[model samples]
Target: MWKFSIRRILIMIPQIILLSILIFMMAKMMPGDALSGLIDPNIDPATIEERREALGLNDPWHIQYADWVGGAITGDLGQSFRFKMDVTDIVGQRIVNTFWLSLATLIFTYLIAIPLGITSGRYNDSWLDQSITGYTYLGFATPLFIFALVMLWIFGFHFGWFPTSGSVSPGLEPGTVDYVISKIYHLILPALSLALITTVNTVQYLRSEIIDTKQKDFIITARSKGASESRVYNSHILRNSLLPIAAFFGFEITGLIGGTIFVEQIFGYPGMGQLFLESIMIRDYTVVTAVVLLFGIASILGALLSDIILSLVDPRIRIK
Candidate 1:
């Protein structure tokens, strides 16, 4: 296991290096430099040159990129060209906000989706199955922004149970219970928006796998041995059915890391996705590169975890 982990990490090093090169080039290829944001149309040339030099804009591209990449290795993400603060600080705050939001979404989606899918698949052709299928279809079919808007209208405007947008209430003191509650209050809408969309699609994937697993020859054999349907399902089918869902779980983690951009934007949450959008709009290359690296690391690690999980849940996978 340790060997596999080390190997995976080593493999990802090149990918990240390549990713940096591409992101840096893409950013450079944009309309202008980071100074474009700060420059005035009537700004004097001398002052502008000073600003460019201050930003190392006049440095050779390779030298600048080398410094950036070198700093990243030392845990310094460089200064945000737009914000003029440590990129590490900005990313840290957004990461904390995103962590909770993503955590809530992952919990809600898996908790509801997995059991609902297994139960429905276990009772295929039943009303429960039909109902679940219909709901999943609706969720997967809807566009994320539209779904978020509708949910905001229903939950925020109509019901008034959950806050419509933002990550927390304004002016709440940090570390207080009130602060925590306010945070939760704001998290509900965006988390729910992401969860509702993911759960439906994930459930369908799990359900199909389960239904197929239950029809295998081993299942028929188990039934012939006078095992109860529940016994066969619990011991054999469920284990095999998990093979496919385990794969989906890998992508789920990636999606959780950065897929909810629309919902995050809609809610005005300061998660990575939201930060990523802000970066893209102004073509903030350094920030965008860092965000991509962050997401890339997370996804690769998640895939490694999912592989371990797959090995555990299915003996066939382990043997191979």
Candidate 2:
């Protein structure tokens, strides 16, 4: 297992490098540089050119890429043109916010999805199963941002049950219990929005897996062994059915980052998703590239995590 893990890590090194190069080139291809947003439109062309030179924006793309790569290796991600701060510091603050939201989303998704899936599969074609199927269909059909907006309107605006925007209520002491509660309170709507949509995939996958696994010869053999219905289903059927869901767990981790872009923007939540959209709007090249690269790395790591999970869940499946 350790050897497999080390090999995967080594393999990821080149993937990350290639992903970074693609991200950097794509950022460079944007219509304007960071200076475009910073410099005055009325400034003389010569002054604009000098500013570019000073900021090293006028250098050859390869040279600029080299400088960026060197700085990135040493933990310097360059400065944010929009925020006038180090990109690392700016991203660091927002990523913490995103992490909490993502964790909440993951918990909510599994808690709600797994039980529904199990029930639906066990009672296939019954009223309860039909109802769950209908709900999953609705969730899958609706766009995430639209669901977020609807949730924000109903729970946040109409009912006033939750706050509409931001990570916390203004003016609260940061370390107080109230502040922590407020943070979680503000998170509910957006996290639920993401989770509702995310749950569709898991429920459907798990339900299908359960249905298929139940018809297998092993399930019949378990029943013939005089096992109780509960034991047969729980130990044989449900355990085998979970393999696919376990494999999907890694992509769900990446989705916690990539999927939140629209939901965060709709809720005005302070997270990497919102920061990413804001940076792109203003052409903050450093932040944009950094965020994209982070997403890429998350995707790679998520794949590794998925493989590890599969190996752990099914002891017969060796990494080698």
Candidate 3:
């Protein structure tokens, strides 16, 4: 397991480099650079050129990429042209906010999904199973934006149970307990918006896996040996069913992170998703690249973690 983990980590290095290159190239292909935002009939051409030069935007693409890479190695992501602040600091704050949101969503998803899936699997073909299946299908079919809008209207605007926008209420002291509680309170709606869709996926996947695993020869043998239904499912079936699910958890997490972009925007939450959306509108190349690279890194890391989990859970994965 240790050897396999080490090998995966080493292999990820080049993959990460390639990912960064792709993101950088894509950012370069955007219609304009930071100077695009500065365009105005009144602004002097020479002034624009001078500012571009100062930003090294006048440099050849290779030189600019090299400089960006160097800065990145030292943990400097670059400067946000729009915010006029260190890209790291600006994005860092948003990352923290998104991290908390994502974490909460994940916890909520699993907490709800696990028991529901197990129950559905245990009672396959029953009304409860049918109802859960139907719900998940509708969830999977509906667009996230529409679901978010409906949820926002119902919970935020109608019931008035949660804040409609922002990470927290305005004017709360940053370090106080009330501040932390306010942050969580505001997050409930957005987090639910993210989690509900994912929960359906999780339940469906887990339930199907469990149902299939229960039909296996070993599971039948366990049941024939007079093991209680709970023991047969929990001690035998559940563990085996989890292997495939664990293998995909990394990509699952990456998808959730990506989903946050639109979900955060809908909720008006101050997370990486919102920051990225605003940056693109303003053509802040530095901020865009930084956020894209951050997402890529997160995806790679999630895959790595998933691989480690698979190795731990299923010895055959490590053996292979």
Candidate 4:
């Protein structure tokens, strides 16, 4: 297992390099340079050109890419043109916010999905199963942004039940119990929105897996061995059924990140997703490339995590 993990990490080195190169080149293809955001209407063209030269934006793409990569290797992600701070510092703050939000979303996703999936599978074609199926369909069909807006409107605006934007309420002293409560309170709407949308796939996949696994010969054999229904279902059917869900976990990470962008924007949440969108709009190449590269690394890591989880959940499967 350790050898397999090491090999996967080694493979990730080239994958990350390729991903970084692709992100850099794509950022270069944007219509304007990072200085576009800094350029003032009254500023002299020569002054702008001098600023470009100072920032090394005047260099060839390969040179710029090389410089950026070299800097990134040493943990310097360059300065954000708009924020006027190190990109690492900026991303560090936002990634923390995103992490909490993503964590909440993941928890909510499984909490909602697993039980419904199990029930639906256990009672296939019954009223309860049909109800869950309809719910999942609705969740899958609704656009995340629209759901966020509606939630913001009804729960945040109309009812004033939850904060509409930001990770925490303003003026709360950090480190206090109230501050922690405010953080969780502010997270509920957006996290729930993403969870509702994201769980559609998980519920459907798990439900199908469970249903399929129930018909397997092992489940029948377990039943014939005089095992209790609960034992047979839990030990034989549900355990094996989870294999596909384990595999799906990696893809779920990417999906959550993608959904986060729209949800964060809608909620005005301070996270990488919101930052990525804002950076692109202003052509903050430093932040854009950094965020994209981080996202790429996250995707690769998530896949690795899924593989480890898959192996752990089913002892029959070996990494080697």
**Who wins the TM-score comparison?**
2
Can you tell me which runs of candidate 3 are displaced by over 4 Å? Answer: 38-42
In model 1, which regions exceed 4 Å deviation?
Answer: 39-41, 315-320
- Choose 1 or 2, whichever is better by TM-score: 2
| Tens digits of per-residue lDDT for model 2, 1-320 | 67667877888899998998898899888888767767687979999888889989978988998988888888899888788889999989998888899999999999999999999999999999999999999998898888889999999999999998999999999999999999999988899889999998899888899899989998899888889999988898988898779877998997777678898899999999999999888778779999888878888999889878876677666555
Look at candidate 2 and give me any clashing residue pairs. none
Evaluated at residue 190, the lDDT of candidate 4 is 94
Rank candidates, TM-score, best first: 2, 3, 4, 1
* Shift in Å, residue 38, candidate 4: 3.1
Q: Is candidate 1 or candidate 3 better by lDDT?
A: 3
Instruction: Evaluate all candidate structures by whole-model CA lDDT and list the values in order.
Output: 0.81, 0.88, 0.86, 0.88
Q: Candidate 2: where are CA atoms >4 Å away?
A: 315-320
Give, for candidate 1, the lowest lDDT window spanning 10 residues.
311-320
Q: Model 2's lDDT to the true fold?
A: 0.88
| Candidate 2 lDDT score at position 105 | 97
Q: Candidate 2, 259: how far from true, in Å?
A: 2.0
Q: Residue by residue across 35-124, what tens digits does model 1's lDDT show? A: 776668488989999988987889999988997788889988866768988789999988988889888898889888889989889888
Q: What does candidate 4 score on TM?
A: 0.93
Tell me the deviation in Å of residue 17 in model 4: 0.7
lDDT of 1: 0.81
**Over 4 Å off in model 4, which ranges?**
39-44, 315-320
